[model samples]
Structures are given as structure tokens and as C-alpha cells.
Target: MSEKKTINDAVSKRYEHGFVSDVAADTFAPGLNEDVIRRLSAVKNEPEFMLNWRLKAYRKWCTMKMKTWASLNIEPIDYQAISYYSAPKTQDGPKSLDEVDPELLRTYDRLGIPLYEQKMLAGVAVDAVFDSVSIATTFKDKLKEAGVIFCSFSEALQEHPELVEKYMGTVIPVGDNFFACLNSAVFTDGSFVYVPRGVKCPMELSTYFRINAANTGQFERTLIIAEPGASVSYLEGCTAPMRDENQLHAAVVELVALPDSNIKYSTVQNWYPGDENGKGGIYNFVTKRAVAHERAKVSWTQIETGSAITWKYPSVTLRGDDSVGEFYSVALTSNCQQADTGTKMIHLGKRTKSTIISKGISAMKGQNNYRGRVKVGPMAEGARNYTQCDSLLLSDTCGAHTFPYVDVANATAKVEHEASTSKIADEQLFYLGQRGIREEEAVSLVVNGFCREVFDQLPMEFAVEAQKLLEISLEDSIG
Candidate 1:
């Protein structure tokens, strides 16, 4: 097929690669039973204590019901029909990219993350996760030199259970939310990083996740803990091939920053978005939170462009005196995509401060919402918050909304909020076209400029990729 024909066909089909893999999978019989949980734990060779923890979470999830407050209209999920565990049929994960499956490498290359791995392997440390397992983690020896513990969550569970046990679920508890409870129950794999006291990581730590199988949910749990005086920057990228059946991707990420430490978490989510008609796409329901302990800091930056249905709120709790929290986000939804995302900041420490900047872009019947909250506790004297939410409507068929909630308990706290919604001005586009830029390029340039604040917050590697993603997502939004 011609390239244009292929693009048109992909748009018509909704899911680009929804085909099932031929590899035999170790799957649990369609259902969410205790036996299924036990078998999954056994397959992972998890310790008995972890099994008990899973059981507790499973029981809690069973009693909970689906939430209906959000503006999402999702189909009822049949937990029984999903394959809880599916991995490429390999006896042991490849030690290097050379030994890894060629098909997997091709997928990453297509998604623009292979170069990221190549750069990381050349002295930069990366923990790359394909489907449910960590494929290759480069520069382990070098990272170890600085006393940084960077490895898969499963590996950390086995090698450094003491650290895992001490901080697991500390930031986001087991019963935090419905999706978090489910993730706590069935999370197969994810990354774990622990920067020891006073040691700054030599390089950026990153995880590239790809979901390749059908009816297989991607429930990964990420936990990062920076001890006293330590600092680290972590990046997470996600992609999935096209599929007809809606896939559930429920993940939980918990970050903890101890005294005098700082943690920066960045995410660029490009999951498979169903076609123009919204046939099949991933239901990305994720819960991510961080706790800034005494005099610590945490910042969250995200660029969301894909996923047919996305519901996420990355939040931070300023629990220590003189701590800081920040959130910068750009959420783009086009062609029937729906996203209700933002952040929450809870100020409990004295002199705590938070800044929120959110940009929402909607086009072609898409719906986007920025729902956020800022809370100042009674004891949080001299707390301050600044919030800004702006929306860009690419077409008349799309919709954008913002809901900001603020509760101030301390009289001395200072808070400010500003929001605006605007459409792409025809005059602006015409002026750019007169300046010799093509219509598409003009639109992309304007959209990029609109999202520069959030893009600048991402790491250098991801900032460029995020810009490219925005260009692709806004291709048809222009005249």
C-alpha cells in the first residue's frame, strides 16, 4: 500500500496493530479469583509476604465499585476476559540489545525510543521494560559506582527487599483508589530507583514501556525514593501497538523525597489511541503521587498525546517544613480521544509552595478536561500557590473544560488562579503562511509555542520527542 493509503487505512481501522501474538502465554483462566492471584505470584516466584500483600489488595478491590464521578463514559470492564500475565516466550531476558528479539527492537525503533536506549547504553543508565519484563538495563556498573540502586521492581524485590519493604506503598497506599488497588493486586513489573543519601545520580534514569500483546493489561508499579540530600531525574515513556479490543493499563507510581532531597519525574505517554471513530484504544487509568518529606521537593512534568480514554492525576504532598511541589502538563486529545487529567497539591508544611501550569489541546470531536486541586492545611503557615490552565481548541467539534478546587485553612496562605480558552486564529495562520511556512508547519509551530512551558520542563531527550508527538497529533487540526 502507498504511504498515504496506509495512513488512511490505519485511521479507518482505529487500532493499527491489534493482532494477537502467536507465542504461547502463561495465562490464568479468564477471571479474578484468589487462585489466579496465587498462580500469578507463583509464576513470578514472589515471596510469601508479597503474595499476602497482593491478597489483601485483591480483597479490597473486590469490595470497591467503579467510580462514576468523572466525565468519562467507559464500558464495563470484564476482568475475567483479560490475560493477567503475558510475556515474550524467552527463558531468560536478553542481557543486551543484540540478544533481544529483532521484532521488539523494531517496535521501539518505530516508536522513537531506541535511540534513547542507544544513548543510555553509551554511559547513560536505562531500565527498558518491554511488555512485562525488563529487557536490558545499561550502565548498571557505573550507576552502582555512585551508590544508586537502579533496577526493575522485581529485581529490587529480590536483591534489596529491605529498601523495597521500607518504602513500598508509602507514598501511595494500597487502598488509595480503585485502579491503584487493582494495580497493587496484579501489577506484574515496573522500575525501582533508590538514590542513597547525598549521592546525585550520574545520569538520567529512564524506563521505556511497550505493550505488544492482546487482551493483556499493563499494570506496572514504579517506586522511587531519594534519601536525605540525594537528587535524581526519572523519565518514563510508553507505547502500544494498535488493537481492536480496549486494553486496560492501570499503573501506580509512588515517589518519596526525604529531607533535603529533590526528585523530578517526567512522563511522555503515547499509548495506542483508537482511530478517528474511537473503535479500540487503551483505557489508561493511572495513579501517581509523591510525598515531599521534611524540607524535600518533588516536581512532575507530563506530555500526554495518545490513549483513547485517559484518566490520570499526578499529585504531590508537601508534608515537610519549607518544602516545594510543582506540576507542568500538556494534554492533547484528538479524533475522539478523551482525557481528564491534572494534578493536586496538598500543603501541610510551613512555607510550602506549588506552581501548576496546564495546557489542554482538543480537536476533531475530542474532549479534554483539566481537573486539579490545591489544599492548604491549618498548620501550613505562609503557604503559597500559583495555578494557570489554558485551553486551545483546534476545531469546533472538540471540547475543553477545567475544574480547579482550592481549600485554604491558613489565613496567611496566598493563592492565585488564572485560566483561558482560545481557538487557533485564522489571521495568525495566514500570517505564518505568508511568511513562507506551509499550513501544516505553521499550525505545528503555533501549537509547539503554546506548549513550550510544559515541553521545557521535560528532559532534553524527551523534550524533542514530545515536540514531534505534538506535531503529529496536530497534523490534521490545521486548515
Candidate 2:
């Protein structure tokens, strides 16, 4: 086949996860108000304190305006037109996988995530969130044996109120940003994890988020805390059904790594980027931050390949001596998609360190930008930071840009930044073609090689999946 024809054929493939699941849902009216928050809190059976907190966040959000970024051109969101809560009508707090609805299980099965423990990946616990509620959590008993607490946010609030109240907004405060504040007021469900002191979680932990309802926004809150000498790794994935009208997904994630502890958080975001003309898709806006104490470590790795418009910056705050933070990411945008994503590192203690590595690939009119910041405080003596950003453009219509911000308040701090932009040159393609390589496969190989550094940081199993996703996202950009 001609190279152009091959590109067109590949790009025409539909998003595999775009089909909607037909399940009855108890949905709220399309509007936002104090009453809606109260109803949401009441439905969840939350305590008085939780209700008060949501009220406070909601009031603040009412007075706040959405912050505008120079690099992002997003349409004005009609908050009153979005349903803030949607849950499976039959959900009654399933005690086990079997108690969950069969249709919900089938939905996950179609998404390649098995809820049944025996049929799922070994040593990996999963929490499946459909719409705005957590449908099921697998391997709870196994996780409990190791003194770990892994369950839905609502469950954590009901079972461990003190812990939930203590660490919920400590990392990302209630009024951190507009979307986060909105989430704080009406978040229906998400995952909560706690690793006890001196205990390392026995297996990998994951959460899969699916937005199956139309005109209903999904707001979920996740909190993870690692006590001293504890360690854990967590993963998150997201998807949404294809629709002609854009949907909203605003989430918040907070990680607290106490002294001598370690935490790793990764995300695989595939939220159904709109069709070639960008008629519809999810508007993904999220806030994620981690606080690392003395001698602690926190790392964030992500593979972002979907969403019509993405605005996110997962960050880390080094708050104790000898603390370390790392951010690794690979973002792919194609077919009218736009992405503005990166990380932030704040060094506040002596001898703190941080590293950032980012890769961006743009094809077929996709626009990708990386904006990051590295800061060293006056007390952060001997602190260090290194940042590297690379962008690859697969077609003449696509564009990539980078913005780096650095602030050094300590003379002893050492910070280095490096960036490069490149295109898939015809000469390089010819070099591979001369060796009998097909144009499509050659493009995939080159793109994968360009992204290997970031992919290597993903878990072994996820790395392979990420490579395949990258290949599929690039199939239409060869022209």
C-alpha cells in the first residue's frame, strides 16, 4: 500500500474503549449548588465534619474564576449544565466481586480489566470506578493481611474517619485550584490507600476509571499515605465513551510520604480523544501532588495518549533533608488533540534532589506543550535538580513547545535544564526503508525508540502496553 493510504487507514480506526455501557444509573440533575453537595454528602452517609468541609470548598469555588493559561485555548465550561453525581442504581456496597452487577463486570471485561481475582493479573489489586462510584475492589483480603488499607474513598471515610480527615487535603489543599475545589465539594468516589509503618505493600495497586454516562462529569478524590519506613506503588487508568458533546473529568490525588518512606504513582490516561475533527472528548483537568518527608522518596510516571484537551501538572514537594522526587512522562497527541502537561518539583529542605524527564509526540494537527517548574528554597542548601524535555513531530501540521521555569533562592543549589525538538526526517525514513522496512512499521519503531527512556520507567507489564499504545497513536501521522 502507498504510505499515505496506509496512514489514512490506520488513523481511521476508532477508539476501542468508546462504546457506552447500558446500565441504569441514579443521576443528579445538571446543575451545581449547595443543595447538590448536601444531597451528595447525605447519600454517601458522610459525617458532619465531611459535610462542613464540602460546604467550605463549595463556597470558595463559587467565588473563584477558572485560571487561564496562555498555552491552552479551552471553551468555557457550563458548570450548571453538568451532572455532578452518577452511580449504578443497583450498587448497594458490594461485599465481594460476585455481589457486583454482571453488566458492570462485562463493561470492565470489554475494557481489558477483569474484576474477578482468579482471572486478573497476579499480584495486582484493582479498584474499579464506574461513573462516580467505585463498583468493586479486588484483593482486599490479601492487602489487609499485610496491614495495608486499600478501599474506596467512601469506605475509608466510613471505616477510618480519623485517617481520612487527617490526610485528605494536606497535600493538595481544598482551595488549591478551581477543578480541585470543585472535586472537593462533590467528588463521589475514588481510591484511598494507607501503608503502615515498616510495611511494604505485598503487591501492585491499581484503579480504573470509566465515564459511561453522558453530560455527567466525573469527580473522584484519591488519597494515599505512607508511614515511616513503608513503601508502595500505585497505578491509575481512565477512559470515557465517545460522544458528540464534551464531558468533564476533574480529579485530585494526594500522596503523603512520611519520613523514611517511599511512594510511586503512575497513570495511563486514554480518555477517548475526539474524532479526527475533534467534535467531542473529555476535558481532563486534574491536580496531583506529593509531600515527601525526611529521607523519603516520591516518583510519578505517566503515559498520556488521549483526551481532547488535557491540563495537568503532577508535582512533588521535598520537605525534609535528603528527600528525593522524580517525574517521568510520555505524552502523545494526534488528530486535533491538545495537551498541556508536565510536573513541578519544590525543594524546601537541605540536600534535597529532583529529576524530570519528559517526551512529547505530536501527529496530524496535534498540539503538545510541556510546562514545568523547579524551585529551590533558601533553606535548601546543596539541593539539586535536572530536567530534560524532548519533542517529536510526526507531520508538518503538528507542533510541540516547551516552557521551563526555575527559581533558585539558595546559592548552593545546582539546576540543569536541556531540551530538543526533532522531526521524522525523510532521510532517516529512507535509511530504514532501504533495509526493507515498511513505512508504517518504521515509524512505529522510531517513535518507540524515541520514547524508550520514559517507557522504561513504567512497570514491566505496563511498559509493553505503553509501547503498543504509542504505536497505535502514531499510525496516522506518517504523512
Tens-place lDDT per residue, model 2, 273-297, is 9999988999999999999999999
For model 1, what is the error of residue 358's alpha carbon versus the real structure, in angstroms, after optimal superposition? 0.4
Clashes per candidate, residues 3 or more apart or on different chains: 4, 0
lDDT for each residue of candidate 1 in 1-479, tens digit (9 for 90 to 100): 22222222222223333443344444555567888889888878888788999999999999998797778878899998887777776666666667776766666556555633444444446777766777667678789989999998888888888888889888888888899999999988899999999999888888888787778888999999999999999999888877778999999999999999999999989888887778888999999999998889899999998798999999999999989999999998887899999999999999999999999988777899999999999999999999999999887788999999999999999999999999878787789879997556666787899999999999886788788777643233332
| Model 2: worst 10 consecutive residues (lDDT sum) | 4-13
Cα lDDT for residue 160, candidate 2: 97
Task: Enumerate residue pairs that collide in model 2.
Answer: none
Clashing pairs in 1: 14-275, 17-242, 18-242, 18-243
Question: What are the models' TM-scores?
Answer: 0.93, 0.97
Quality of model 1 by C-alpha lDDT: 0.83
